[model samples]
Target: MSESLQTLQTGPSAAAPGDFGWHLGMVLRGYQFLFEEAVEGMPAGIRGYQILSTVLHRDPPNQQALGAHLAIDRTVLTYLLDALVDAGVVERVPAPSDRRARKIVATDNGREILAQYEERVATAESELLSGLKEPEADTLATLIARLAMDVHRSQPGSSPCEAMDHLP
Candidate 1:
């Protein structure tokens, strides 16, 4: 067939080790496993970490905006928030601009938890990039972040998250 098809059929070459997807998949899997272990006792695991970080760092979106941004369903986000609230990690506060709207905010305990785990998460991430040297890791991080932003900009609002249903 075509040259490109032939290349694809050959799989990873001896020198290349892996294609982009292979590398990305490996990193994703590694982080998921490591992060799970790191945040073992946290509610919702990785999702909980994401929620805590977002609420702590971002402008603190309301439930609807939070769900949309995170690609979590309204119902599911509601349940997650309930758990987070019960855990004393987050609280539902009235939006400043609109009292009718409720926004998610991290409690002092939540901020402390985020601070406590930040170093742990960083260490796990560093372990994932153990193959790279210090400079290489920094360069790779910069390049990957730039690439991610480019990809995001290229796709206005075509996130696969929109089409996919929340997994059980």
Candidate 2:
């Protein structure tokens, strides 16, 4: 077998299929697949979708503050924002308090696109979590949210996931 396959086979197995790590990897891959397939027509990838959604919810957030919140580095965030700006999905405005700071805001077109993507994403998520009942899914979400909040609180500079760096 290939080295990668052998490594996976020998790794830890906290869940049924493989170790917790393996399961996490599979889950992330699944999410990526769904996001790519579902948002094919959208101008942004999953990360862009997330950033657009976040900006819509929290309008006019400075680039640095937004990057910190989303755990995205300045370089990647710049590229993502540039793409969104090019697509007319988001706009960068001057900060009210700081002339040097640039704030991100979603445009009307961006909001409409996000709304469509939201429905698609929700459907995809429901399908992905079909193994769980509604209540179980809700409980799982709550638990995950709590854990995430705790981790964020404990780690001052750490973001949720490194992959999320593409989003903010």
Candidate 3:
């Protein structure tokens, strides 16, 4: 196993109740670390991959909707989209219903890169959760997805990705 994966499986030393946040921070860092190598060539690391994934999956109505889903600022999203466009991975198209509004779409190259990234990410995730049995891992995934959706619903206007960061 890779060193980072090993470290994550073993984890840091235990923490006191009051240090729960610290422990979670370490855990999140480990997860990010696992993806670091896989996303090395991508723009904005995981965030950029997320933007691509959102574009491919949700087919959101426009740039604003895309930003809302990812919880990225409008200006930041524009900057990121610019890079993706330059890379020939994505495009901003004229919205059919409104000339002023623009929609985001993935080009063929974007779709191919996204497909490759998704495969690598899936492998990394499976390794990250190697300690869990299949059923347990599935349960954890379900719970986390539900939690994120619930938070997103409760906090209107906040991106589901950012919603987790807002928890006390």
Cα-based TM-score, every candidate: 0.79, 0.79, 0.81
lDDT of each: 0.77, 0.80, 0.83
**Tens-digit lDDT string for candidate 1 (122-167):** 8889988899999999999999989877876786454434422231
- Compute the lDDT of residue 48 as modeled in candidate 3: 83
Highest lDDT among the candidates is held by which one? 3
Which numbered prediction scores highest in TM-score against the true structure?
3
Summing lDDT over every window of 10 consecutive residues in candidate 1, give the lowest-scoring window: 159-168
Question: For model 2, how does the per-residue alpha-carbon lDDT over 24-60 read when each residue is reduced to its tens digit?
Answer: 5676778778877778777658669878878888763
RMSD of 3: 8.5
How well does model 1 score by local distance difference test? Answer: 0.77
Estimate the Cα RMSD of every predicted model relative to the unseen true structure.
4.2, 7.1, 8.5
Give model 1 RMSD, 1 decimal.
4.2
lDDT comparing candidate 3 with the true structure? 0.83
